[model samples]
Target: MKQNLDLAPVGNCSVSALIDRCGRYVWACAPRVDGDPVFSALMDGDDPEHGFWEVCLADLKDVEQAYIKNTPVLRTVLTDTNGSAVEIIDFAPRHHKHHRTYRPVAFGRIIRPISGAPRICVRLRPSADWGARRAEATSGSNHIRYHCTDLTLRLTTDCPVSHILEERTFRLETPLAFFLGPDEGYDQEVGPGVAATLDRTVVYWKDWVRTLYIPLDFQDAVIRAAITLKLCAYEETGAIVAAMTTSVPEFPESGRNWDYRFCWIRDAYYTVRALNRLGAVDILENYLVYLRNLVDNSAGGHIQPVYGVGLEADLSERIVDSVEGYRGMKPVRVGNQAHEHLQHDVYGQIVLPLVQSFYDQRLIRPGSVEDFCALEAVGDRAYALHDQPDAGLWEFRTIARVHTYSSVMCWAACDRLAKAADALGLADRAEVWSQRADTIRARVEAEAYIPEEGRFGASFGGRELDASLLQLVDLGFLDPMDPRQVATFNAIERDLKKGPYLFRYVEPDDFGEPETAFNFCTFWFIEALHLNGRTAEAREIFEQMLSRRTHAGLLSEDIALGTDELWGNYPQTYSLVGIINCAVLLSRSWTDVR
Candidate 1:
């Protein structure tokens, strides 16, 4: 319960909450992932008295936590010094109900005694206006309704309301259930409905996990990562968020925090590819809808780097001065400004996922002519802007460059479009796109490669190395074994590499040098190493990275190279994608064992 950082996440796709080891609901957004945090204690400084919902044992001694096997449901066992214990089952209700996903803006918990009688107290505090105001509470016999300015939450419980309101310690006689959601009264008994939802939710998650094409090795790690990725998705609109929390610093006092609760095209592309490899087409199909929506709404113009989970275009960035950031890292940010930048790589990210629909017959909605035509407009942007400068994938605030990675992705966009066109039997369109891809590839090789240094540069002509260059092999711009790629890998390892982790880049930016290592970049380096015939080394490094995950088998966006501490947002989609991808590449095939 005393653990400060390295928090674990639990959520249904619609909403999520970060629960600390002390069995406290520290952070949760309402209605949607990007909504105002109803429980904002994670960013409310070190105060444990407000902005949180917690069930505290009067004489707590030991605490142990884990997920209900193969599920997102979390189980925490708290043992009191008096030799009494209670199990806390926490989850967001998610299962099939009435022919659709029953995920709601809700949080549920059941506390059952596992040993002798245990004394417990409940602290339920929800906030609004980014922690500027606490919810006004009103209670009846079995429920408490907390009303905020724009939102209300009803806490239906099986325990006495007096015990909760007065914070009185009571002996555990029967299992108590609490359900928090949109301030709507329950039609049935709270205990039975929550119990049944727990049963079904467990089945739902296990059944989904069974469908995964997980590798023989690291199956648990891969499955855990996969579950986090699924939780990060906004299922209603098929938009996948980059992470659950926002503005957890990338490094101590480095001022490198950003809101990651929105969907980044590049991050979604990598996330879906990982899920696709696991044979999870539902996520891919849903994300394609988000992408298609973007293309349709683009009005035949450029696509932004990021967007709201519900496809809102203008995400104006601002800071919340009310709530102190995670670990008192001030300037808690809400909205993202990356929505206005022209990150050319998005054009390719959009096309890459759409390309899969054309060939993968597993998808519910395969590629059609309308989809192709819409995507053609996206490809047109990639071609026209391939040589131009924009905010790179890193989204540097002050600088723009024709980054090698962005250019390579543009080439990938045209290249995949040509292939998709040919598959669709549009020969003329295929020819034109093929010629365009050739032109882009030629330009990238001529300008992105540093001939004097015998390797590819981060920008068109600069000599700086970037971890994103690890993507050149992935995008098919260069062979993994090509001499230039080999040299580039060597240079990256020599410069950006810190132990087993890799920094995105070391150059000074508006915020000074990025002091932390990007977790996903290290995975990219492992893949590159494996592709270049360092298969054993790749497996070793891959294992080391796996060891870096939190106790919940999840990772944040960035890690401190100096202290090996997780510093960024929780359950980062990119970090999980790295886990899935590296496991797929390095794990030995089942055929080998057979």
Candidate 2:
């Protein structure tokens, strides 16, 4: 049953869980949550066709992917050349809502066959530690265990086959086949009834998804991304991974690779908002608990910008040379070293969603108010160290710089804190925070803005344009029509645009050398343009971004300016959220489009 065996296929290293279509098998490494990877080497590897056990993708000619409502179940329909088609559904359980899915995955389950009658096959060959962890195939049963002290995974295939791909260090995915003739044959063969387990899995997602209140339009994309994000999230801890794979090059042929399996405070905040907006308080609240634990666990001195998916903020990253990277970029990395940077504004970023919880949803109770009080206490520390230089948003490896964007977000922190405090009737403290907010805002305006360039630079004493400044217009730091906002937008258009890809800033960031043009920054540019009354331009920019989705309706973190190959991880939920949110911002505006 040799169907589609990719011997040497490219893997997505940018974000985890992105399926390299050229490679075929989906790659994911999580449960680390902090960017410390559990899986590695996704781009392209030595053995093109890979797998200890093959995951048979229902022979698909017409493959359409989507999520099931509000849950994170990824559904794809595959039609074979024989016109026999099946819908393959994938979703690593989001946070355990009703205590159903145990063992919250650093890297976990991939459920298949939701609704279809195609001969289905699955080949699962998990390359642990980016293919470094040794494996001991359990005799008899079709299960293999990757030997690791911190990491444990058991993979089973539903099909009997020659598991040749798993024998050597290879790239791409190994092959497997499913013959769908009649009567759940695969189901009867496996004990405990595979059909029943699959059914329960589907029910698990369905019931969980039903708990959320979806939007009127763009509901599908939102729920899908939201759910996908949750699936990537470790259940007990609300840490959502940046992606699943490691060392997917941000720029093709350039050694600009990074792993995003860890959970970021920033991304968690976005998850909060998306959940809050979608009317689900559980995940958001659980994430708050995760943060509380994270803060409690590592609350001593300085806070890292991100944490492992399991809530460990400490991650030391190094390169693995056992396999070549996607398209020949070597030395794919496993852990993230961003744990040792001074990202003061990260507290503010984390606090934003908490602020939203306080102001917008009111789901936060009185004890939550106490939580704010403690968080505000930390704000005092930030105020004391605000003027000092530190790593900016990108968390660069070099010496910290006076990143204006960090300062700007720091201002936002105070701004949100003041408002939240005021709402909670702590007006006196609010006033003090408000005064500090004014100071930060004044510093951002005075120091970050380059009047000569007619835009804001990445840092104080620097004169390069940044995409973050575009948020000034959206976040209302500056009115969309203000001279400064206009100037910043123009400068971003001039300097930051790399074809369709846009950089967060023109200057080099801390995540290693900036290579691929960032995709979400482009979304921010569109949001700025739309908010600034340039509706058509925003629409055009948005269209360009939409056109960049892979053969799958997914996006990567960045895009190569030349090959247009998605740089970074595949199926980035943040990028999709950007596209969905921005599209909604444009299409269904409450205000008139200028």
Error of 2 at 413 (Å): 1.7
What value does the lDDT take at residue 519 in candidate 2?
Answer: 83
Q: Candidate 1 clash total?
A: 1
* lDDT scores of the candidates, listed in order: 0.89, 0.59
Candidate 1 matches the true fold with a TM-score of 0.98
Model 1, 403-442: lDDT tens digits are 8888888899999999999999999999999999999999
| Candidate 2 structure quality by residue, lDDT tens digits, 528-575 | 778778889887888777776654445778876787667776556568
Clashing pairs in 1: 1-22
- What's the TM-score of each model vs. the native? 0.98, 0.80
- lDDT value, candidate 2, whole model: 0.59
